[model samples]
Target: MNLPKKAEDAHAALAAAFNTGDVNTVMSMYDVSGFIVPEPGKPVSGAEKFEEAIKGILSIKGKMEIKTVYCLQTGDIAVGRSEWSITDGDEVKVSAKGIEVMIQQNDGSWKILIDHAFGAEASLVA
Candidate 1:
């Protein structure tokens, strides 16, 4: 299906918010009952809870860059993959892969059902 622009925009905004370390913005991307798969170091479930879980990483000096937004919609359910990288100052902290599952609400807005982030490994920049 050709997913609506609003849905695509929302996902894009989510990526921006997440990369910028904006707690409120990031939290805004989820539904009340929405869930997250939790990167290896993060906790699962609840928007605020997941926000708190990522604080540690956000605390460390870094900038997040997201790439490859792959989305597919089946009825009202949408799933996407977000590939990301973290740069700590001039060094690359990590390069990760993530996936999101979203549900379209009756209001025609979208909410995330799952947000999972993880990496294959951590490598130091040469």
Candidate 2:
């Protein structure tokens, strides 16, 4: 997997890898300590778990489109938000606005530390 040179490019890297349906490449974009919120309340960690979560999405067999909404960085850490969607031809498979926390590695490539897939959604009244 090719890591993004800038934090702003993380979403694009992920979208490209996801569009290719390569779980390993997608997983490679994450840091060893990273975790992902595949569901609003469920955070999955570990390579095996992350890979499983990614596999489920890949099964949708849609193309991923992600646009960076915002990104703030200081030192080696960055936080970003993005609006994303998956489409299979004319049908929308998934759509969401999310947040991601990333860290710049020693090599100056950014890796995802936390990916909250639904973080930008409006909270329900409970």
Candidate 3:
């Protein structure tokens, strides 16, 4: 799959990838050095780590829905705020807000740099 050119496109692509239950496709949106805070204080980095973190979600067998609340871009960097949910049929299994930083690569495609999946909830708990 091709990388997303814009923030909204990234979210759409992510949702599509998640629905397929393909971990490799989901990880394609992240940069090689990208990291995600899978929980309150623990941050997982690199492709291998990310794959491990994402496996649990895939096991649930659901489709993802994401809405980009806002995105601000400057030069090659962009910050985005979004709300996302994983649903089984009409029932939501998990929902959360996220804040992420994306970097525009040389090819002008956006790849996630830092993904704080829990958003403010993580800090509140810390």
Candidate 4:
């Protein structure tokens, strides 16, 4: 699969890949040095660790959808926000907002540097 040419494209690609239930295709969106926040506060780095979390979701057999809220690009880096949801038949399985950070590679393809899957959740007051 080809990497995204724009920041918003990354979210679209990810949703499409997730819907396919192909872990390899979904994993290709991330940069080698990237890390993903699978949970609210727990960050997972490296391919092996993040792959497990992705697989868990794919196993749910739900269709994923993403709507880009906004994307700002500066130089070769970009940051985006999106609203996403997963659905099984007529029922919604999961719905959330996320933040994605991406960097454009030498080939001009954007790869995800940080994927905060539930980043938009409200934070607790201290």
Candidate with top lDDT is 2
Off by over 4 Å in 3: 122-126
lDDT of 3 by residue, 1-126 (tens): 788888657777777878878888878888859788766577899778988877876787778888888889999998888888888899998888888888998998988888887775544464
1 against 3, candidate with superior lDDT: 3
Error of 1 at 122 (Å): 14
Q: Tell me the alpha-carbon RMSD of every candidate.
A: 5.9, 1.5, 1.7, 1.6
lDDT (10s digit) by residue, model 4, range 26-60: 88888858889876778888889889878877887
> Please, what is the whole-model Cα lDDT of each candidate in the order they appear?
0.65, 0.89, 0.81, 0.85
lDDT of 2 at 26: 85
**Any idea what lDDT model 1 has?**
0.65
Task: Choose 1 or 2, whichever is better by TM-score.
Answer: 2
The alpha-carbon lDDT assigned to residue 30 of candidate 1 equals 75
Per-residue lDDT of model 1, residues 7-78, tens digit only:
555556665666777666667677747656555654377656777755655665677776646778888888
Where does candidate 3 have its weakest 10-residue lDDT segment? 117-126
Error of 3 at 7 (Å): 2.9
Q: Predictions ranked by TM-score, top down?
A: 2, 4, 3, 1
lDDT of model 2 at position 65? 97
Error of 4 at 115 (Å): 0.5
